[model samples]
Target chain A: MIIIGGTATNGIDENLSKIISVPLLKVEHKVFPDGESYIRIPQHITNQEILVVQSLYPPQDKHFVELLLILETLADMKNNKITAIVPYLAYSRQDRRFKEGEALSIKTILNAIARAGADVLIVIEPHKEEELSYFGKEVKIADPMPELAKEVSKKVEKPFVLAPDRGALERAKRLAEQLNAEYSYIEKERDRDTGEVRIKNLPELRLSGKDVIIVDDIISTGGTMIQATRAAYEHGARKVISVAVHSLFLDNAYEKLINSGVKEIVTTNTIPQDPSKVAVVDVSPAIARKI
Target chain B: MIIIGGTATNGIDENLSKIISVPLLKVEHKVFPDGESYIRIPQHITNQEILVVQSLYPPQDKHFVELLLILETLADMKNNKITAIVPYLAYSRQDRRFKEGEALSIKTILNAIARAGADVLIVIEPHKEEELSYFGKEVKIADPMPELAKEVSKKVEKPFVLAPDRGALERAKRLAEQLNAEYSYIEKERDRDTGEVRIKNLPELRLSGKDVIIVDDIISTGGTMIQATRAAYEHGARKVISVAVHSLFLDNAYEKLINSGVKEIVTTNTIPQDPSKVAVVDVSPAIARKI
Candidate 1:
């Protein structure tokens, strides 16, 4: 099997190399002055099962388009089978059209990727499981949150798992179960017009003498994490940390999170930011076994 | 001509109805349970010269995509001509790929709108004129800065035009020439890695008893405006006011600007924000003559 990793998949590739003995080939991506992207596989991989990994995070459309282009190039290069490993799928939040005249952008994005030539697709903890049909791939991975939390717990002692909001409670619960730690979720009231969320009933879950770890599937804007950290500190948490499957870290998000009271944030190498720490889980091995 | 307006368009239809004897349509947009968007136009607009006015300011992408879908629906309804009047165009800052592997998303967005079936486009004082080619339309217009400055000058007997940065000196000079006011530009130093900018030099441009008007094309974070206001107040200005063509105010931007000692903030109804004051310019008259 030949493996190609995007900005997010580098960690998965490293872990997979250590787990199994396989030859890997990395794709080099560059952009021309005229604003076109160029992608090339350095080594020949005729009839090889290729695993192309990428995360569709913020700037969702651009990253999704780049991934499609990469898949198209690999297909044309005569790769036997193509598997897409997307850690954090963008447009997942946009699953359905709430009103008339709105395009089902998530469906459209998925169709673009499938049409570009991905035979199997793997996603980790999608916002909604029903979105799986959007992809024409045969394989789908759901909820890698347990394994990720287990890996995080191994490094730290007495880690208390936290969910920034009730919407993220399921993932936090699953992670806490795996880590054998206490788990609690914060409630939030969001302003419909502005998309501004206010955390409520947060100080109730006092973590006065515990090492807290905020766990979520994705961190976009980092607003929730910041609010959670402030509440945690006010309620007397010893130290606060963050771990997520996807660290989207939107514009100025990293600095905001760090300045908001998070001692150290750990996340998978999901979106190619400097603060992305801890690469505990790898999907390449699972994909290889499934295929 | 058929006009569609909403909060995003700031009742532009009401203004247009006075000039032309055409039916005015108001667009109603709402969010559904599954976090999807819904849009409805109250009147029939088939085979009409349709003008859909909207601004993509804060909640930038959501409002932008909503406008695109509305345009698509209008095209599907067999409108004879579709013109999109976006006064406050967001993501224009990403015109160039500042870093490696970054996409020129502004162009992609323009292409998406064009593909969605907008025959002509109108924007007010885009950050750069070179971005006009990115759109596949001709009905572009400059901000009514001169006219607006004259009106503002009438309010304050003695006024001085100040450019927030050297990049905006031309605009300040133009406004100053129109109002016959003194003009000055701030020298700024931006940290490349963090995107943090600081004023490098203040050359003591005395405004001891004069009303200072800081002018710019757009205000996204309001950081520059905040610094400018502080500098103006420290320099003994009697009053400090901020005026911009497009107000792409992000989260907490308005509050931050207000707290930074700005006496009054004035912007054209480019973006539909409650804080926006003064709308001296209208593109409808100019666009009507052009088309």
Candidate 2:
């Protein structure tokens, strides 16, 4: 197998190579004077099984277009089989229309990827699993929960997994089981008329002097995590550690969470992050196991 | 008619509205912690003929996603008619397979845009006209040449239009006719063996003491324009001004062209530019005339 890494996934090729033996290809990219993407692949793969790795993270559109150009180039080269490994899939949040007139961007993005000659798509914990078929390709979803749980285990002793809300209970339960710790979820209530949200009944699990590990699939805006962290502190938690598969940390979410008394934040290297509260764990092993 | 503007097309909305007399809707957007695009269209656009103005230029992927979101939102909102006005269409260069097994990115992009509920796509001077049908929608192409010619008329005296190469002679001829100026094309020769390029024949039109306007649809990389500029200077042209519909001064192309002694560069407001070599002229009237 031949692995190709995009601009964001530069160092990741080494990680994937450690798990699976493959020759890695890197994209040489430059922005043209007219702002057009100029990409050149140095390696040649005539009839090899190709794996293209790129994360649709910040500067999402540029990375996405780069991926398309790479895929198109690979397709033109007549590669035998192609697998796209997108660690962080952008536009996954709009899986369904929340309200009338909402765009389901994920569906359109998936279709474009599939059309770009991606035979198989391997994503790590997309926002929703139900919409995986939207791409109309062979889809492989690698869950980073088990891997994230392993990272959480090393960070704290006397741990208790807390789901940010009821929706993320499954994630919390899985991580709790992996860590051999107690698991519980907070309740969230929204005022139907005013659209004001407030955290309802706290978890029944005793939180006093325990390392509270908040497990969620994604940490966008950090509103839910912030609220849960505040509740955890109020309920007598010793150290609040937030763990998620993807850390978008939009705006001042990380700063806000740190100020809200959260001790640590651990996330997978799905999205690019600067070293701070973000503890990026490798998910290559999980992807390699499936491959 | 309801006009909507994407992030890049904010100021252009007011210009478009001034011509069409419509309520302008702007998408308030932010990146989520998880890198998901959070877009909110403030205006109500139910059952109305909606025109969304977005230029898919640099950061092509993000702008493309925004356009998709807006289209999808309008679709979900059950808008009567959705018209997407993409000033600078990305992925237009790869309209056809240059080699076997090419992915044909433009076709996929068009399909995605069509699926996103863009009933009509209004583009200004896409790379090619033949592939417009690939969109499978009511595609209205608005040419900004006349408007660009009007801008050129004010910029120079004793103007003579010069196509950088033979292929763009048609465009140069059209613009020259519009400006009532003499037109000619330079001959370019590429060494098939060494892959080196050289300008062979200069234009027959005497370039001495006259404003020589180089015209083309696109000015990517500015290699051709730079070559043309050098040849014009060598042939004793008094002033050299480059004109194009899309000015994609990739990398140091802009600086290189300016250094090569081109007097001024004028491009339509199809793509964004800084206040330097590029002078952007508004083409809203052209689009509005069609609407």
Candidate 3:
């Protein structure tokens, strides 16, 4: 059995190999003069179990194409045991066709992965688990919430976990169990007429002197997290820390969160993170245990 | 039948519709704050022939993803008679695995397009006709050589067409026939010992002080065109003009061609072209005749 680290892994594949004690084969890649992606596997492995680790980081489309090429090349090599590990699946949120003629983006992406010949699939805390059904393979979930909770606890003493909405309540429950702290959720109610959202139920707990850590799966734009953080402060929480597995701080979201009185924004190495912009905690150990 | 222009079309789709006398429905697209590509098709027409036009320009992978989304979205809307008109087919050069453990990149791209549900595909002068086989469907080629010849002829009198190599002899023959000019090919002989190539046959035409034109399928990096231009000037030609269907002037190739004393560089609007960099000729009329 061998593992091949793809170009889009963001160094997480190296850590995954170390934790799992597996031989890792790295794929060499470069761009041609005409701006085409070129990838080549260095070592030849025949008829053996192979793990392909790649992430859909931005230049997300380029990374996604690399993953497709890697999987298809492995399949062409007669390696039917290829397992694709995409840390954060791109286009996962575009699963629904809310409008008249919108693209079923994740359906197309997942179908392409299957067509690329990945026998098994693994992803880290996808936006929704049901979206994985589009892959049409034996899919495994790699949860980084528990590990994130454990890591964020080191920054704040006695962290109280909170979920931004009901859909993310399970993530908060798992993290709260890891930290052994009280957890609650903000009930968000959207005005159907105006499409404006307001938090319905902020817990009336005596959270005056406690540190609040809001946990979720992905934090892009930081809209919901910022609102939840403000609500926690309104209830007299000492500090507000935002934690999630995938942190795509799009459009200066990290600065916006900090400006909105968020003490610290912590996330895993799912999407490539800037250390100075957001605090990163390792989630490779959690993935290693799953694989 | 109606046409829809994609974001990557670079005005070719609009010109195509105008030339073919078909209504054009432009696709609405934007990038989300999280760096995901979003596309929506407005003005749906059910059970009609839909022509979707896009190009594989730089940031090619993103454009490819958009193409897939458009095709699959049309398929989902029960539009089975969808025709995908991609001006330039990327990854076409990576058709063969020259080295061990290398990807047949074009094979993966073709297979993904097939899975994306494009019923018919029309491509402008591909790298090789056989590369289109990876698409596994009936593909129509839109040759712009004759049209480019007529356009380039307006600049010089009594042009002599020359092929860079034997593989591009057919392209030169077509263009030469259109201009009623004599054409010859440069024979490239590679040293089996060191893999160094040198031109064996430079045309020995009894032509002193006449315009020489070099035509090929694609002009990428402009290496062969520059070499052929110098050879033409060495043969006592007055001026050298370079022409091709697809112009991917990668990495200062246009400047290199100019520095080599090329009088004019002409190409079609297959890939996105800067007006100041190279002169673009219209090829939409040829495609309209085919369709």
Which candidate gets the maximum TM-score versus the true structure?
Answer: 3
- Candidate 2: lDDT of A278? 75
- Residues A173-282 of candidate 2 have per-residue lDDT tens digits of 88888999998999889989999898886556579999999888888888889999988988889999999888888878889989998888998888777766578888
- TM-score winner between 1 and 2, please give it: 2
lDDT of each: 0.70, 0.81, 0.85
Write model 3 residue lDDT over A1-291, tens digit each, in one string: 788999888888899889989989999799898778998887677798888999997888999899888888888888459888889889999989788788889999989988898888889988999989999989999888667876687888868888889899888888888889888888889899999999885556556878999888888888999898888888888999888889888778888889888988889887888898778877788788788
Worst 10 residues of 3 chain B by lDDT: B200-209
DockQ of every candidate structure: 0.05, 0.36, 0.74
Clashing pairs in 3: none
Tell me the tens digit of each residue's lDDT in model 3 across B93-184. 89888898898899998888877988778988888889898888878888887778777888889688888898998888988898999988
Q: What residue runs in model 3 are displaced by over 4 Å at the alpha carbon? A: A191-195, A201-206, A276-278, B190-196, B201-207
**Candidate 3, after superposition: displacement of residue A86 in Å?**
0.4
Interface RMSD, all models, one decimal each?
8.6, 4.1, 1.2
lDDT of 1 by residue, B98-151 (tens): 543344546655655665668888877778777768776765664567556755
